[model samples]
Each structure stands twice: as C-alpha cells, then as structure tokens.
Target: MNKVPMTVAGEAALRAELEQLKKVDRPRISKAIAEAREHGDLKENAEYHAARDQQSFAEGRVMDIESKLAEAQVIDVTKIPPTGRVIFGTTVDLINVETEEAVRYRIVGEDEAEVKSNRISVTSPIARALIGKEEGDTVIVRAPGGDVEFEIDQVQHI
Candidate 1:
C-alpha cells in the first residue's frame, strides 16, 4: 500500500482513537453483547442484534485504523527548520491579493483535512498551488469560482 502522509498531531489523534476503541469500546461492546445474550432468544432479541451490529462496526473501524497507522508516514513539521516554504504539516498565512483579506491554513493529510478548522489537504487546489512556494511569493489557485491570487505572508512549523 502507498504510504499516507500524516502530521504528528494527526497521527497522535488516530492513535488515541484506536486506543480508546481497543481498550474501552471493545470491552464495553463485548460486555453488552454478553448481557444481551443472557436476555433471551437470540432470534428475536433487538438488543442482541444491536449489540452485534455495534461490535461489527467497531471491529471494522479498529481494523481500518490499524491499517492506516501501518501505512502512515508521520511528519513532524516542528522538527524541520522553518524556511518560509510551504510544506506538509506547515501552517500558512495568506493574503487575498484582490480583497486583502487574510486567512490561515494548515496543510495536512487527506484524512486530517478539515476546512472549518482551516486545515487543507495536501492535494487541495490551494495547497497544491502553495506547495514549493516561499513566503512573499504570490500563487494563483484555480477555484471553481475562477482563479484567485494569494500572497504568502508567513509559514509556521508548529
């Protein structure tokens, strides 16, 4: 499988979720299943069926997380020297060339991209245009609304 790029924080979050699922959710679901089984007929017991479904979903998630962890290429931006160049895991401050509006974005993995939080996936149009560019450089991004120009104000490795 191809390696998936992930920031240190992203990797940590996934690990934490995996830990919670394995140590807490897994055991809790097993107990629920056992209790449901004791309630009576397996054929008609809604609780038993629900517990089973939950268990299946949880187990599937656990496997998915494990596979992602195995293929994750964790990148700690803080460990790299800041060169004002946009890169994965780096937070970038940009100024809209036309509107003069300032916005900040953190380049992260596909799974970690949350536009609401200003974290953009590396493959995003904006990020793609920003990557390899240094601070003070102007980049043009082709958005669905048309082309937008931005000036790179700052790059942070935090």
Candidate 2:
C-alpha cells in the first residue's frame, strides 16, 4: 500500500478515533451481541440483526483506521523551511481576478480537507495550481465554469 499523507492534527484525530473504537465501541458491541444472543431465536431476531450490523461496521472501521495509520506519513508543517513559496500545509490567501472575491485556503492532506474550515486537499485543482507559487503570482485554475485566474495575496504557514 502507498503511504498516505496526513497532518499532525489529522493523525491525532485518527488515533483518538481508533482508541475510542477499540476501548469503548468494541466492548459495547460485544455486550450488545451477548445480550441479543440470550434472547434465543437468532432466526428472526431484530436485536441480533441490529447488533450484528453495528459490530460489522465497527470492526470494519477499526481495521480501516489501523490500515491508514500503518501507512500514514505524518507531516509536521512547522518543521518545514519557509521559502515564501507555497508548499504542502501552507495557508494561502487568494483573490479572484475576474470576480475580485477573496478566499483563504490551507493546503492539507486529503484526510484533512474541509471546505467549511478553509482547508483544501493538496491534490485539488486549485491547490495544485497554487503549489510552488509565491505571493503576487497569478495562477490559472481549471474549473467547471472554465479557467479561473487567481492572484496569490499571501502565503502563511500555520
């Protein structure tokens, strides 16, 4: 499996989730399954079916998280050298040339991309265009509506 890029914060979140699933969710589901089995008729038991479904989902997620952690390549943004050029984990402020609308986005790993928080994936079209660019550089991004030009206002490492 290929190594997956994840920020320090993202890694922490995943670890916490994994811990919760193992220590809490796993035991809870086991208890539920035991109680469901005590009801006796497994042939048409709704409780058994529901508990089994939950157990399947919980176990799948535990495995998935473990796999991701095993292949994760955690990146510490603060340790990277500042070159005034955009790189992974850089927060960039941009201005649309045509619309004059300003937006700020932090280029992060795929796991940390959340548009509501102004974080975009590094592989995204806009972030790809902005990568390696310095302040005041104009970058054209291919969008669904056509190509959109954006001027890099600032690059902040946070």
Best-fitting candidate, scored by TM-score:
1
What digit string (tens of lDDT, one per residue) describes model 2 on residues 11-106?
A: 999999999999999899999989999999998999999999999999999999898889988988789887789988888999999999999999
For each candidate in the order shown, give its overall lDDT on alpha carbons.
Answer: 0.95, 0.92
Question: Candidate 2 at residue 100, lDDT?
Answer: 99
**Residue-level lDDT tens digits of model 1 in 1-158:** 89999998889999999999999999999999999999989999999999999999999999999999999999999999989899999999999999999999999999899999999999999999999999999999999999999999999999
Model 1: worst 10 consecutive residues (lDDT sum): 75-84
Cα misplacement distance, residue 110 of candidate 1 (Å): 1.1
Clashing pairs in 1: none
* Cα misplacement distance, residue 17 of candidate 2 (Å): 0.7
